[model samples]
Target chain A: MSGRVDIIGLGPGAEDLRCPRAAGALAQATDLVGYVPYLERVAEDSGQRIHGSDNREEIQRARLALDLAIQGRRVAVVSSGDGGVFGMAAAVFEAMEQGDPRWRALEVAVHPGVSAVLAAAARLGAPFGNDFCVLSLSDNLKPWGVILNRLEAAACAGFAMAFYNPISKARPWQLGEALARLRRHLPGSVPVIFARAVSRPEEHVEITTLADARPEQADMRTLVMVGNAETRLIPRPGGEPWVYTPRRVGMNA
Target chain B: MSGRVDIIGLGPGAEDLRCPRAAGALAQATDLVGYVPYLERVAEDSGQRIHGSDNREEIQRARLALDLAIQGRRVAVVSSGDGGVFGMAAAVFEAMEQGDPRWRALEVAVHPGVSAVLAAAARLGAPFGNDFCVLSLSDNLKPWGVILNRLEAAACAGFAMAFYNPISKARPWQLGEALARLRRHLPGSVPVIFARAVSRPEEHVEITTLADARPEQADMRTLVMVGNAETRLIPRPGGEPWVYTPRRVGMNA
Candidate 1:
């Protein structure tokens, strides 16, 4: 059998939200590899040999998948959101570039999926309506200074921003620092959304303003989105607020 | 019968790339409103009434969908990519906010689809594997100054960037100007991807570097991606090159 690797996204927490193309990759795979939580979401009846690893073991997991593919096994490397964004796709490529040159000859495909950014944005209306930037707040991969700089730049540019891995047990203050940096350049009334476990039963969405946005509102599972200067909110009589950023820039802007 | 509006994305192009949820929305839609090209892609035998409009008529198209929804018809406002990202979802919300107060009462749901950004990135091997910013180079909605400022900010901040609507017949020089701005902040060898009509039969993806990137490479249908400083490329013996931004940033970055 020809060896191949499919980097697939599970898409937030819902099965239906997963792209049909990604589902096809999983169906054809002989081995599955991802974080325990993501791998658990796949059906046991698929009969694919599964290898579940920790979230921090991305490179190792990628290596395992690459090795399996090199051995002529159909391997599917899974991620919770779009694999290309801070997910397995990068790790697999990194491994291929740094590890075995032979791995480059193996067939590889990255199947796009509905990302957490899209999933959260869909659940909370169209807050990401216009131009936006996405950043990961964890300093483990980069530095605190780099994250803060990007946050400030995005805020100053009046771009809607989505933050991933905003808060974790080891790095709790980064989210606060990010919000504070944005507050320096933006007004207090700018809208902020904290979407946790999106599309899942335990999903929670918190919509507030910059002045009211707290670090406690976000956790590792939370995807935080801060709207641009012109983001607007429409209050409903008996439901959650609807929020969106207008597509057009203001006259002065 | 109560009317509703489903703002759905058709994905980049392919039928299978379209989200199943979005397909369901189209199937349930009694009235469809979108640009002519997108509207033409929907199946004709679905029995849905189609309202095809001009490319620049987003607001008017949104208004028509809202009016149909208010008149107790299921309306689907279709966009080629995820509607939340520079698509019809914002226009629908903007129209609802400005046109009729009753529109606030109408049921509106935004169904997320695989965006062109994701689709293009997947085809090109995770060039967006790290944090990135997305901007529209078209200055029609926003001023040229704003687009230039964003281009500078994104390039300076070391974010991988995606440019939507990079070039049009009338505004041909913007892409070149945008590339020139990036050339200042990014190295000469930084990878740039020009992905056109992704997932379509005529789709083409050109992988080049900042030094060789040209304005004429892109058109209206193309999505351009510029990798961050740390992005890497893996060359195959007999295939197209693979590109990805490493998950970890440099010490200085």
Candidate 2:
């Protein structure tokens, strides 16, 4: 118990996906704290009890991670995907403001890895080639009204969007609600790329229209990217698909 | 050579920066084609003379790469950043569209990489937590009018902006012009983060304001990320400066 708190990124799940920097930090950690699913992503023998918590207990888990850091533990907070992207990095900072004398001495570092949004966008080529937003449809953290307001604003701005935590087993109807709102501004034929368990063993990317997207097709592992009106899907040789956002400023068409 | 031309993403600069799948593609490449600056980034010996091109010869060089691919070279038209973000991948497609019929028959895939934009944004504590756009100020192929239109749109929409190729030796005042235009809509004190040579030998980041940023402070190697109305500069305990874009929706405070 003589090291700073290191918030490590587990990349997109696979061990090979771990950034060298994230791996190095995890190797040096004595304690790992996160949700059970995220904690399971780290393979190292943590030598400390896994601090698992339900989603509502994130505040408590964050506080415990910081307290251990204050006690000079080589604490590792495991966040799947990049630590900063809808992950645990901000929660750690949220709990850091607690006025503890020992906490003041703790060093905190956020090692970034690939975000699933970017990974999903990549699989669908240029789905995010222009203005974009990453929004969570879950109402657990914020009021649904606020989500609707931001969704409307984002849609009016005409940015390609990636939805995170879009559909869960209990929240089947929220995705439909969000997509219904998207239909108000976005065209019905806007290409939506839904990638499940990206960069993991059971990874698959499905392409469909926004109007045709179904919650039955998605799960917690799915990352959905919806293209802007300018995005084009063109067929290529041998069943390989190609999608592109038209060059906005420079190309001679 | 009965192979195709593929724009492989080597990820960021480091071998570890590469995606597992992208790394697999690079290992299978028989020919590597890119500018001298980017060609040097490829680690493996593909046994093909690297297609070196001057800065002004990008169009011709891409056309040449397409020609070689038409002759059935398993050519990997390499680019430093994510191929779609101001990289040569777009140019290769342009060249292909205007090339010989045989060239159009070959398959082309644009594998995404961890762009300098993503890398720099991560270092800055996720200034892109909200809506954002990445645009280049380099007027080589784009008209100033078009560039200004997008800048105006982004600024008016209050979008966080990441600028690539903001300025070079010959284009020293481009940033000043961009700043002047951007400042007209944004507040004079909006925070600007200049990440120079990110993840490279001379890597460093500097924080400045709209009215205070000097043109000489940046060159083409730099990435300028200007935060939006909600971004805050927090003096963290680690003394590594941090900027955060508020999640905009959930302000329980």
Could you say which candidate leads in TM-score?
1
TM-score of each: 0.98, 0.84
lDDT tens digits by residue: candidate 2, A1-253: 4658777667777666566777878878878888887877664584666777776475577789888877778888887777666777656655654446456457777776777876665555556555456677777766777667666666665556778888887778888888888899988888888889876789988888888987777787788777777667755566645565544544564
What value does DockQ give for candidate 1?
Answer: 0.83
* Prediction RMSDs, each to the true structure: 1.4, 3.6
Error of 1 at A40 (Å): 0.7
lDDT by residue for model 1 (B1-253), tens = 4999999989999877888889988989999999999988985856888889999888999999999998999999999989998889999988988888788888999999999999999999988888898888888889888998988898888889999999998898989998998888889999999999999999998999999999889989999999988888899889999999988887642
Computed on alpha carbons, the lDDT of every model, listed in order, comes to 0.90, 0.71
What DockQ, on C-alphas, does every prediction get? 0.83, 0.32
Q: Show pairs that collide, candidate 2.
A: none
Query: What is the overall TM-score of model 2 with all chains considered together?
Result: 0.84
Residue A139 local lDDT, model 1: 89
Q: Which ten-residue region of model 2 chain B has the weakest summed lDDT?
A: B244-253
Which CAPRI tier for candidate 2?
acceptable
